[model samples]
Target: MDGPSGSGKSSASRGVARALGLRYLDTGAMYRAITWWMIEQGVDLGDAATIAARSHEPVLTSGTDPDGPTIHVDGVDVGEPIRGSEVTAAVSVVAAVPEVRARLVAMQREIIGSGDIVVEGRDIGTVVAPAATVKVYLTASAEARAQRRTAELTGTTVEAQQAAMATRDTLDSTRKTDPLSMAVGAVELDTTALNLEEVIAAVLGLIKERT
Candidate 1:
């Protein structure tokens, strides 16, 4: 799976994984985990060199269970910390670093190699796993995406979330390495009008047809 933030990748991916009896991996959480670690270490986010140098220092582990995935950094469970506003705001910058993406993409490929899994992220279909059996590029209207994200996050208005998402989208799409893009032959699903279950069903239908 590949999509911008608030495009229903996480929810739909997990749902598809569960229904198919497969493991689920949220690659975005991996980036967020590293970002959380960097913040904890007080690395200068403005310095890409520093960020890249320290990117390999932290050990990241991802739990693949679709019911409840977990992310840990350096032996400490960072599932909650990585979802904070601080991490959310800086994850794109951290993930944009070529070195950081290289390290995490290696880890992601290792996990995917272990078994049949549903992986969701901005670049999975395009860069991380180009040969994935089922490639899906999900999308949604900007307003719909903002509303969905606002409902999930606390203390954030739809306007703010939409603005932040737009910025992240640009950064992710324009990065020098492993930019966010739809894989050739991948299915494009616009989730603007679909509910969660409907989106999942559509993905499941796609999987049935393709696989």
Candidate 2:
């Protein structure tokens, strides 16, 4: 699965994974884990070279269970810390670094190679797993996306969340290294009016049709 933030990628991905008895990998959390590590080490986010140079220092481990997915950084579980506002604000910049993407993409591919898994991220279909059996590009209306994000995050209004998502969309889509895009054979699902179950069912239907 590949989509912008607040497009129900996480929820739908987890649902599909659980329903299909497949492992789930949230690639965004891996990026967030690295971003959290960089912030904890007091690395300057503005310096791309510095971020890239130190990107390999942290070891990231992802627990692929859809029901209880976890992420760890350097032996410490960071599932919550990586979701904080600080990490959220800087993850896009950190993820944009070429070295960072290269490192995490390698890790992602390794995990996918282990067995059947559902991976969700901005570039999974186009970069990480181009030949994935079923590629899906999910989307929603800007307003709906903002509302959903506001509900997930605390201390953020819908307006602010929407604005931040817009910035992230621009950054993720325009970044030079593995920019966000739909693969050639991807099915584009606009979830603007679909709830989580409906979205998951639609994706499952697509998988069935494709495979």
Candidate 3:
């Protein structure tokens, strides 16, 4: 799966994975894990070299289960912390580093080597798992994305959330490495007008037809 954040890629992928009896991997969480580590270590996220060097740090690990995946950094479960505004703001820079992609892609391949996987990220179908059984590129209008995000996070105004989501979309699309893009032959669906159940059902239907 590949798409901008808040486009229902995560939830849809999870639903499709469950329906297909495959594993679901959230690749954004991996980048967030590294970002959390960087923030904790006081590393300069803007410095690519520093972030690359720290990519080798034995600080990241993920649960093997597909039904409920977990991520740990530096022996601590920083899942919640990694999703905070601070980590979200800096993760794009950290994720842009080639070293980070190399390490994370290796881990991703290892995790899905012998099992079915419904991996969701900015570049999974295009770069990480080009041969995946099913490739889905979920999308939504910018306004819809912002609204969804605002609803998910409390105390966040709709305007502010919209602006932030726009910024992240730019960062995610223009990064030097594998920026957010739809894979060739990947099915692209605009979920801007669909409810969660409807989107899930659509993806499930796609998987059933494809694999």
Measured over all alpha carbons after superposition, the RMSD of each candidate to the real structure, in angstroms, is 0.9, 0.8, 1.3
Give the number of the best model, judged by lDDT. Answer: 2
**1-211 per-residue lDDT for model 1 (tens digits):** 9999899999999999999999999999999999999999999999999998888899899999999999888889989888899999999999999999999999999999955999999888888888888899999999999999999988989999999999989999998998889899899999999999999999999888998
Where in model 3 is the C-alpha error above 4 Å? 64-67
- Candidates ranked, most accurate by TM-score first: 2, 1, 3
**lDDT (Cα) of model 2:** 0.95
Cα-based TM-score, every candidate: 0.98, 0.98, 0.95
Per-model lDDT: 0.92, 0.95, 0.85
Q: What would you estimate as the lDDT of candidate 3?
A: 0.85
lDDT of 2 by residue, 27-58 (tens): 99999999999999999999999999999999
Q: Model 2, stretches more than 4 Å misplaced?
A: none
Candidate 3, poorest ten consecutive residues by summed lDDT = 58-67
Lowest summed lDDT over 10 consecutive residues: which window, candidate 2? 108-117
Best by TM-score: 2
Cα-based lDDT at residue 60, candidate 2:
92
